[model samples]
Target chain A: MAEIKLNNLTKRWGDFIGVDDQSLHIKDREFLVLLGPSGCGKTTTMRMIAGLEEPTAGEIWIGDRMVNDDLPKDRDVAMVFQNYGLYPHMTIFDNIAYPLKVRGTDKSEIRPRVEKAAEQVELTEFLHRKPKALSGGQRQRVALARAIVRTPKVFLMDEPLSNLDAKLRVTMRAELKHLSRALQITTVYVTHDQIEAMTLADRVAVMKNGIIQQLGTPDDIYNNPANLFVAGFIGSPAMNLINGSVTDGMFVTTGGTRLVPVKSPDREKAILGVRADDMHVHEAGQGDIDVTIYAFENTGESTLLTVQWGKQRVIARGDRHLRKDQDDVVGISLNQDHLYLFDPETEDRIEM
Target chain B: MRDNTLKYLLVLPAVLVVFVTAIWPLIEAARLSFTVGRLNRPGSLDQYLGWENYLWAFFEEPAFWNSVWVTAIYTLLTVGLTTVFALGLALLLAPGGRLRSSAQALLILPFAMSPALIGVSFRFMFNPEFGLFDAFFGIVFPPLADVSWLADPQLALAVVVMADVWGWIPFLTLVLIGGLASVPRDTVEAAQVDGASGWRVFKDVTLPQLAPVLAVVVILKSIFSLKTFDQVFMLTNGGPGTATQTLSHYIYFNGMKYGQIGYSASVAWLMVIPMIFLTYAYAKFVFRKADQ
Candidate 1:
């Protein structure tokens, strides 16, 4: 397995910059995901690493060798395209066996390798079937099998799981993570789906525009975001950002709602970031903020209540039976230790 | 009752047209095959000949058999050569860029021109003494300078075939272009990534996808080439000892030109049998295989 490093890579089409100057180092056997919205250059970055696209500037190094001039095959890398570009005319056997046969591997070795790979993907029964005869999930398995059969140095997957149904996607996500670990190959995966990136990545690099906004372990990027963009982009019900000013070293909202700063008192006059699950709701007099519970949704395991503190909406996760349309005075309390402080002007974190 | 009558009335024109134009003529032709009277004569139900005309056309008539052989040779030669040339051009121009539309327009110019114009133009170009064809070929073949292309009984048929190829290859090329263009670009790229070279990609990925379209072009070109009359009429007028006389030309010469209506109708029967077989074979082999 090889570690891949992008040294200030940038891609531009005419005047429009597809990927801004970005640098990242993916460790050996690491499952690194570049996650962003569409047009955020996540796929472009993976393509540059795969040698399918040329970066407008900078170099890509796989292990010790600079691979900017190498073709995809020469770089010892394989890609599972989003469309699962299987040769429609060939059977699944030939599709999975192609790379081996192309490298001029011996005829005797090709059959075993193909069967082994197919068995790993649980596709032994489909070896004789054409791609048109297979379902979407089966086609995905074939693409995965094709990538793994050669045991290349790196695997580049561009939204490979996006085509499968939601249930299949979850199953395939877990399988891909396990397979990456078992094979111990460096993989650079690109997807706009935040959940896939969170579940499959050893480390997630959240991007915006064409620049890397944050690069850290999934927990670090989620719990400790570097900027407003990262804080807003990583979470599902999304992290709540309330506009407030530091008054006497405490963050107070426009409606005079106060929050205990988990950060040091020196970082004053900043925005407060809190996770939706971190806020607790109680009877009006027992909490710091007197908010109204506007709506509640029961997610089977827990109730998610949308509380309005002053003019802003905040979500609270709890086990209380709050009615969906009930308007009741509620008390809100912060988690105390997990609150984040970001500079109001720059939107960057104000760490104490 | 009203709705049923309205539906039947809506379809009445088409049903009546098919019965009058197609099924009626077929039934009449089958009946005429056993008759002893010509088409211009008042046909009588009493004139029962009982398949004598079929026997005479097949075994006794030399010109009818000669026409059959000539038509078969012309169809095979024209369709075979046209298919090869069209496929070659389609391969060259299908994966096109800046020059694609211009090449397509140039290729389609032949199909847009009338076949009679095509034939006349070819005849003037292939004239023995004054034609540019002899001069151009004389530089390469060298022996073509001494040969009279139209007057020679042996080469007159070859000239007709060449004329038909020029007039018809464009349609086949156009059809195959649609086929080749529709071969998925992603599949081609996948083959390349699977380590196939240019020729292998075409043979493995492209040829299989193009088989149905190629079959249609071949069958249609064969049918038209078998009945080709415009080029033969304008170029040689079926001269040089009937060497260039095809089935359609034979029908024209006998029924209209010579007024041997009964004999020509009998010759027409022989031609329809192969056409029926070819159409059925194509539907079975090519289109059925494609659907499967």
Candidate 2:
């Protein structure tokens, strides 16, 4: 397995910049995920590593070789495209055997290797069938089988599960995790699905506007976001960010009401970031702040209450047993240990 | 009022038009071939010939066989050359940037010229005294300085084939470009990442997807080549001891120049046989593609 390193990689098309100058070092046998919304340059970064796209500036090193001028065939990397990119005219057996065949492997060694790879992906029975006859998930498995048929130096996957149906996506995601663990190849996966990055990545690099906002373990990023963007982007139901000012060591809402005590010097303007699960809902006037519930939603495992806090709605997760309707007064208490304060002007987190 | 009835009814006008424009002429030609239909002798039009014209052309006429041989070689040369050159041009133009797209747009200009005009231009270009190609070839090869291209039998046929190929390449290239565009881009990229080189990707992925389109191009070009007459008429006029005479030229000479309408009609009917088979094969490919 090979480690991939990007040194100040940049990609530009005329005035439009696809990827700005950024550096990343992926360790050997590590599963690094590039996670971001559309147009965030995650796929462009992976394509550069695959030698599919030429970097406008900077160096890409795979193992010890600087593959800046290498063709895709010389890169010794296998990629699974978002559309699976299966050869529609070739059978699954030939599709998987193509890399080996093109690399000048012996004929006798091809069939057994193809069979073994197909078996790994559980596609032994569909070897003779063309990709057009297979379902989306089956085609995706064929793409995976093609990549794993030959042990390449690295594996690059660009949202390989994005095209499948929701149920099949989850099943395939689990299979992918198991397969990646079994193979232990250096993999760089790109995805916009936060759950996939959280589950599949050993370390996730969250990107925005062609820059990495945060690169850390999934737990670390979720538990301790570095900035306002990461804090708002990482959690489910998104972290609620309330605008307020820190005065007399207490955070005051814009409506001139004192909320919670924070251990920070007085600032003219600050934003408080809190996750949905961090805020506890209680009976009216029983907690820190009394607010009317704007809406209540039961999501089976937990009930979520969107309450009005100083003219802004903040979602709070309560027990599944709790039932509250709109206009119902609920007491909301901020968990001080989990609260994050940020300067409104800089949009950077202020460590308390 | 039903869907099935409405669909058939909608196609009725087209069927009637085909019958009037196509089927009627074919039936009339077949009928005229059986009679001694002479343009110069009106009284002989009703005289029953009973396949004498066909038998005469098949056995007694060496000139008819000569035309057949010339037409066969011409068709083969033009179709093969046009397809090879057009496919190469399509490959070059298919990637599509500003310069390549402009070149592609310029290709249509040659196709827009009439085949008769192209033939006339080729004749002027090969003129021995003061022609562009003649002077260039004479200067490049001094042995050909005094040679008259149109005066020689073999050279005249080659010039005719070249003219036909040049005139048809632009149209065929445009069609093949459309075919190339329809091949999935991802499949080619996938082949590249699968460790195949540039040429291998084309051979394995691009060519296989382009097979159906190439078949259409070949069949269409063959039919057009077989029916070629306008260029030959304008350029050689079946001269140089009838060296560049094709089947259509032979039929025209027999019916119009010699007034042997019945004999020409029989030869024309013989030519239609090959066209029917080609049309049937083309229809099969089109329908099979639709099924997919």
Candidate 3:
């Protein structure tokens, strides 16, 4: 319901900084995910926006109002903590009704609101149960219900599904995505899990060391990473990065295997990035790189082939029907169009 | 099998100490309460008295019953005040930041002080002469000069209760503060975001979380208050016409002072019965409920 903007926000503890100078703009009704590794200040950024933590400097504006001085409740935001911090003494009914009660809603209005929120989370039947009596997934639903009952302008979720089992986490992730669209609230979710960020976010803000590494749609981040960190961090089995140089208008690895550039242009010493899906194995062809298979993983429907050339080993996803295990030299073809180049010293993207 | 035997051998010394120091004394006390002995009649082992001393305590001795009532009143007042003050201090101190450690250390300093020292200090302060309380009041009512607080029937008992509260509240507060500190910060933050005010957050989130610890504080303070003797003995010596006399003081008066060993043993038994019942009932009622 409100657009949030952080202008040079920073958080510090004595001499140490939790979140360095960072700036981000979250549009209204957009699901923006702050994704990063642990201790990278994703949660700290979310807490600052929610007014649960104070920023050391700069300002936070929400829907034209500078709310840096406001308390969490005054900021018109509801948060779902990673631990699903439900009051253990209160039943689910009271827990969901707490926000309404605090806001001085009418007695008649509170009942239906609580009921509607509970119904959305599929927790109507367990209304009278305490949090301790509920399972992990059920408790998360209660926490979600508690947030939705208020119908606040913004929803802040800090890795809310991280506590559930793998299957439950998947289910909850889908549920949260669906619920965010239905509620149409400006939501900022923080998670270290890239899969969750990829699936749940309308726009993912990849952060590292308290700074935004890349801020774009999932496809923009996955296909055209702005830097080496994003290119390496955003993908599974990750993008294969190898040190290479431009010679004779062809990208050549240190092992002297020449990769015919799909787009031949200008490049010197730069890191070459290629996705696993873009690479095709060639036994022998016009444009092929010879490499010996190091290992192969069969994951039911697909197989991952890890090949070593010189000191470099890169994993490529392939069809289970095509490749088996370690064998003789295999020929591989690279999708030159999808290849990314990064300057080795700066770790910054270099124009190809 | 060798490891199990070695583990048992390691704990043998602890088991022996429990048997000799704890269980043996309890058994001896039970046996002695059933027998009769006097200083002069120590050589004769045929002095067997069953429930006569108990009967005398309950019916024949009016002063004994009065002492019981006084002790009960003092214990209840001391425990009740201490529990209330301790819980309040814990709530105020548990949220610590920069000043938290200093505040906690200062609060616990009173408990670290010796009870005998506390008694002497309070006695001197409340003394109607050049003492603090009297001197402060003497500015208003100059007619009040050197009024003996320990000699007054009502003031003597009040002073003992006050001294006990000062000595014991810090201990209860420290325990409750540790318990309150463990109340999840996540739960409290959730409540705050849910639009709960300060009082509501404490009532719904903190109070329920601290129930088990508060129960412990109350029970421990009650047990200590019931057996209180140091402050009263050091200050008033159970004087002011038996006004400040507790059961422990009465037992001391009979056994050591008057040398009525048989009678004193009976009074001690009379006191121990209620304490045993209380300990059992408290563990069953409050502590068990808290565990759930």
Candidate that would win on DockQ: 2
Residue pairs in clash, model 3: none
Candidate 3's C-alpha lDDT? 0.85
User: Distance from true position, residue A180, model 2, in Å?
Assistant: 1.1
lDDT string, candidate 3, B5-120, tens digits: 99999999999999999778666656655667565666422367888777877889888987898899998899899988988888888888869779888887888988888888
Query: How close is candidate 2 at the interface, in terms of C-alpha RMSD after superposing the true interface residues?
Result: 0.7
Against the correct fold, how does model 1 do in TM-score? 0.84
Cα shift from native, residue A145, model 3 (Å)? 1.1
Better of 1 and 3 by DockQ: 3
True contacts kept of 3: 0.62
- Candidate 3, A138-200: lDDT as tens digits: 999999999999778889999999999999999999899889889999999999889999999
Residue B86 in model 3: shift from native, Å?
2.3
Ranking by lDDT: 2, 3, 1
Give per-model TM-scores: 0.84, 0.96, 0.92
- Per residue, candidate 1 scores C-alpha lDDT tens digits across B106-225 of 988889888889789888988887888867888789877788888987688888888888877787888899888777765665555555557777887789778778878888887788
* TM, chain A, every candidate: 0.95, 0.97, 0.96
Q: In model 3, where do residues sit more than 4 Å from their true spots? A: A262-268, A284-287, B1-16, B34-36, B40-46, B106-108, B130-148, B281-292
Clashing pairs in 1: none
